[model samples]
Target chain A: MSTTRLARTGGPRPAAAAGRGRSLWRTVRASGWSYAYLAPFVVLTAAFVVYPIFASLGYTFYDWDGIGEPSDFVGLANFKQVATDGYFWRALGNSALYTLVLVPVQLVLALVLALVLNNPRLRGSTFYRALYFLPAITSIAIVGIVLKLMLANFGDAVSKPFLKLGLTDEPLQFLGSPHLSMWTVIAIGIWNTLGYNMIYFLAGLQTIPKDQYEAAQIDGAGRFAQFVHVTIPGLRNVGLVIVFLAIVGSLQVFDLVMVLTGGGPFYSSDVITTYIYREAFGQVGTGVAVEPHIGLASAASFLFGLLLLVVTSGQMLAIRRLRARKEGK
Target chain B: MTELKGARARRGLTHLVLLAIGFAYVYPFLWAVGSSLKTKIDFLDGGLGLLPSRPVWENYAQAWREASFGTYFVNTLVISVTTVAFTLLFTAMAGYALARHTFPGKKIILGVILATYLLPHGYTIVPIYDLINSLGLLNTLTSVILAQVGGGLVFGTFMFMAYFSTLPRELEEAARVDGAGFNTLFFRVMLPVSKPMMATLGLFTFISSWNNFFLPLVFTLGRPELRTVGVGLYAFTNQTTTDWTLLCAGAVISLAPIVVVFVVAQRYIVEAIAGAVKA
Candidate 1:
């Protein structure tokens, strides 16, 4: 029935290549096991991960509820609305405010902890290391829900202390107050991630070579001076990677935000991810759930994803250039 | 003598700070463990204490039965193990090929694999799921395992390829010269040499597959029978007025395997990560 069989019986089916047919089959037979190993990865990735990007991007250009063939081309309409939309700006503002406050404070806290733990003479070093790294392996959904409960359960833990110290007259509802939700989200991230980042810092610390630290000490360098002159400079690339990663991770912040705030306390904590999810996955609230806005959500997703990719890639390039210039590469 | 005195003062301050941080870090874990033993009233009784007066170790068993997590645990283990197994097989073979073989189009294929690593996992979710569903794999362990394999391979391939690039090719060539062929050289010779790297990759992949949340969440349809520990653990806390004891119990059971892995494999982890960094 097939050309290959016909060719075998009738002298190459047209005299093109009688010998090549068997060679190709033979080649396949030999590497069949390799293909067996590779099939799962390739099939899953090509179908699930790679295809979604193209599909979602295509969805951005069409108005389809994902249940019908009556798709309408709403060219760039979602993008236009998202750009001009007040809610979009507010969402961006919340993320920016969160990051601005969170990153520096978290970094300082982690760095201080790292410097303290870098003491070679410390007892229970391994136990302390494991403790610090604990939160990192927990699932985001669990962390999100647990942190929310803790905040709610012990509102006085944060609010009463701040208020008792005269920081504010009113107790802040960290997750309930629109003003405080984003900061609390940031705090959750820092708690979960500090150890992972600290490990990165520790690795960078190793590259400094203990001899340099000894030399600095011999030259009458204070601990602060050694850190300022040697440790900080030594950590530049790792810092760059950490900063870039944190920025990217911040942009992709969705699961925790969804579980904890649901982009709420008045839609004040909504970012692109939660906004996209709500649009695409029917936000249920206040006695009614809306239908999916597949087209609009897809458009917004593309814009957000593209912006994130560009920012992260740019940061990576800048870091490489800085590294090269310093290394005289 | 002045230097010694200053060093002593700084060391004392460092020790104090380290001790404080160590307390903060360890306290939450202790609280989680302690609270899991408390009754609902006991949990509501106080903010945080070292241990409960009445330890209800049965909460772990009760939570297990309530969620029917016994079934889900087996499902997760199967999917995770399958994923790690496949990822190691394919990524290593492909990595070995890319790193050692001077084949045509090798650079282009390797480049493509590297590029895929930069794209966020979320980007491909729709297409991949659609394909799986089209193939009648929706809600199947195979589908989840497949997704994990893909996600893990990108990193696994990169790490292994980087590792193989550092290995000596002469040994392999000598085997090849002896008419050993590709399969024999790869399996009989090259693989035996990279046992440590493979073990490291296995540990990394196993932990990642165990901790995977998003893939299971998206694919498993919240079917209590199909969820991984990462997704299933949220059942306790997704509701308002979460029972802290039950929640902590679930968290403990969920994290146990990973903690054990971390504790047992610390030496290999440190070595692998340290090697990865320097390379």
Candidate 2:
């Protein structure tokens, strides 16, 4: 009887082990289809998105001019060159300045407009929303092109009255003078993207329950008091997000700046992006031939990316701290 | 009575301010359209005046011929359409896989994909440009489309994955119970049901692809004939002495399709942004 029991137990044990093995194989076979679905995205992303990043990182350590293989491994020399470059710092500062001036002004304007448009009693609000949102949809490059042409051609015409009225002796060079170029770009940038933020703020407004405003009204809050107490608090989360997006977006300003200023008049309005473009592709429209520096440009790009990462993380940390404090209170 | 009068006046003042700002906001495009229809002299001398003394309709034809915008338009359409197709196909398949199936290495794959979102897109162009050059695909529409698709996959896949996750489990169970295979379940069952998500993503992809300048510019640097409208227009402006009217006409041509797309799909576009932000 004992011998019989041992035989039976051993028999089931091998069968159970085999069954488990079969099930695992079944799972892997089932997952074969899943991997097939993921293949194209994986392959393309690996080749295009993920690979280029590492490739660029590799390029940053060399001094190659984008032709043939990068042979000269300079070992952080490119990074040092970028760090010491005056033009690099200028470009970085200009980008920071653009974000600083743009975020507050754009957000405040967008919020004010959103409040006006969000009023349920407002007539033709949809029309006004579409009207304001027009520039945001249009291509920034095309917008820059048209504006550049208009300012170049009719700038004198528009400024003629000012000139005649002795507002200024010379015709205002909207894009020519270095002092006015960055401001001009910023003004156009605001106009170009104001509608997007307005829409965002409007969306935020939609999330604020109608009863809260009514509650505030019943508590004897006037219009300004209600805005200060209710709307501001309601918009806090979305406001942080909008601020973050605007800052990041402004820092990456490329197409518009390229079309509008080409970072011209001795790189006065040059953002980091334009600076990188100049290094990678040479001076595009200035009839000047400068050798393309793939290594240097890649180094600059990685450095700028690092800086952006630091800034964004700092912003996130501050936001978290603020939220924690509020919750703690 | 005084309160009612004051309220009416306040409403009127608000309308006035909005109207004025709205006009200033749209005045650039209006000015461009008006200038496109103006004679060279009218355009030069018109000064802030929107209406041309006499509309010159031939400027469009002239700009079309001179800048070869016809070729550029066709190129842009082909590139944009192809990019959207590949993007939708790859992202949808991948998103479905990620959402529905529990597979080995899924977490690692997801981690790798998410890690890419942190990389700033600005500096990577050098390597991408070089990659295209080495592949011997430089100055071709294929290169442009490939780069656009590759660069855009992360966002599309993420969006699609989120969308697919929200779908009911019974969808797959029903398909499987009906003896439907994996491909049939995805293509016939799941993809058809995800029409709204597709539309939202497809429209955005189309708009961005149409307006894209940098990739097209860099990839097609050696071949101007293959340049898209955005790059072509930039090139047009770079001529030493530009015809302002023709430039304006070119701008209008580039802006027309997008403006129409926006006007027609504004509701979807707005809703998509709101939805994305909420998510």
Candidate 3:
């Protein structure tokens, strides 16, 4: 079967090379066009994407203000500072909180919406899907800005009706109060990206064959039982991927927080990205002026990246183990 | 008859629920556009009402002039277009090569690409900033465009590679039978045939570059005149004092182009995203 597959694919096979050197040279010559084609991408990625990662690692060791060369070589001090800093911890905790709240809530909401819109019998499913997804395509920064303005201007507008209905006597400060800011940001974050997850869930729903539902019905399964037995199990793989993507995306929340509150009423909504941005480029939109600390920011960034790596790999391993145990059963 | 009526009622409820949620989802944008056209006093007093007593068309013009949005709009266009063009060309060539040819170091390249993709680089801007500074391209549109293009190439290349791999081998053979050389075949046949993929990638790139705030903000820190609409709007809020109508107008202006793009290409964009997640 493998040989037939290879034959069908039809690629140039080595003609029993007498020596490795000659075949290597022949292969290189044959791939000239490939090298030519790959040159630009290789050059650009190496320069911009890959090199910056290593360069930032190097920057983490020094106390640089992003002005001149790194004459002040403070070894591990930046990392130590990042490790011990209160604001860094706050930012890290905020990011974790954001992800912890966002992923499950957003995923559940998305799945429910997907199920609703996935019904072929439902009229105007396409229109509903598009309507839900419209915000996902718009810039998050714009969304944050518009929401900030609306909340500021329309705070009374929203509160008046609620107050009259006796929902609450007091108006809410969405971005002002320290207690409310992070939750408010989380709510907006969910709204902003919910559509992407909804679309993913919709696609996953399509992949689960209709025959499974029919089979469940034949077994006297109710709607809820069929969902539990067929839908959940069928969506397991795609569900894992969606969860991973959502968590990763949430952990890097910068634009919205930066624009909305600038991580403030006093570091309440500061996620790791906003923390890094503030350190690297001082605090913008705030009246206070602070110096840019590139080294500390780099350290903070690398630390967060390391944490993400561990979390993601652990998730992957858990997934593998679960899959293996199921197969074993 | 009663059972059928019950089913009909259930469907109506579903639509009702969906319509309500959908309205809430889209209400903020609708409010922004409405507020943009409202007089300042009306905006303040209208509270939840979407219509203005009289439309304030001057708000958009004032936003365009006062915020320097015209310049920022032009800069954003140039940067997004250049970045998308370069990204498409470079990624297509590399993707086609990777898909079609067997070469030494291919595994290494693929491995590096995968590793980079997995590792989050949200904070790598520090070094990238330093690198661009050293190149004497700091505060220039070129810096922003280059960074955007470079950062996107990995994902674009990966996408194009998958797309190219799915194309039938018979097409390449046919081109070769017609005495087409590598360059001729790719430029004339392969690239043209790949228009749909290009559109998908191009639309994605355009939306991202158009909406991007951080890179443009950081790169153009020294030159406020060089800000994109996103950065410019942010600055407008900071510089001006509670010009709520103008700010709303500015936000709407910045958002209009991208919304139009999304509306026009909604089908392709949705499919592309869905396809990407599944893949």
Q: Scoring each candidate complex against the real one, what DockQ results?
A: 0.28, 0.51, 0.59
* Candidate 1: tens digits of C-alpha lDDT, residues A145-176: 65676677777765877998899998789999
Regarding DockQ, does 1 or 3 come out ahead? 3
How are the candidates ranked when ordered by lDDT, highest leading? 3, 2, 1
Worst 10 residues of 2 chain A by lDDT: A1-10
Q: Which candidate's DockQ is highest?
A: 3
Scored by lDDT, the top model is 3
* Total clashes in model 1, counting residue pairs 3 or more apart in sequence or in different chains: 5
Give a tens-digit lDDT track for model 2, residues A40-73: 8998899888887778889888898877889999
**lDDT at residue B208 of model 3 (Cα atoms):** 97
Score candidate 2 by DockQ.
Answer: 0.51
lDDT of 3 by residue, A203-224 (tens): 8989999999999999999999
Clashes of each: 5, 0, 0
Candidate 2 local lDDT, B57-82, one digit each (tens): 99999888877888888999999999
Off by over 4 Å in 3: A1-23, A161-169, A322-329
TM-score of 3: 0.95
Compute the lDDT of residue A256 as modeled in candidate 2: 89
For model 2 the local lDDT of residue B65 reads: 85
Model 3 DockQ vs. reference: 0.59
Docking class of 3: medium
Give the lDDT of residue A164 in candidate 1: 81
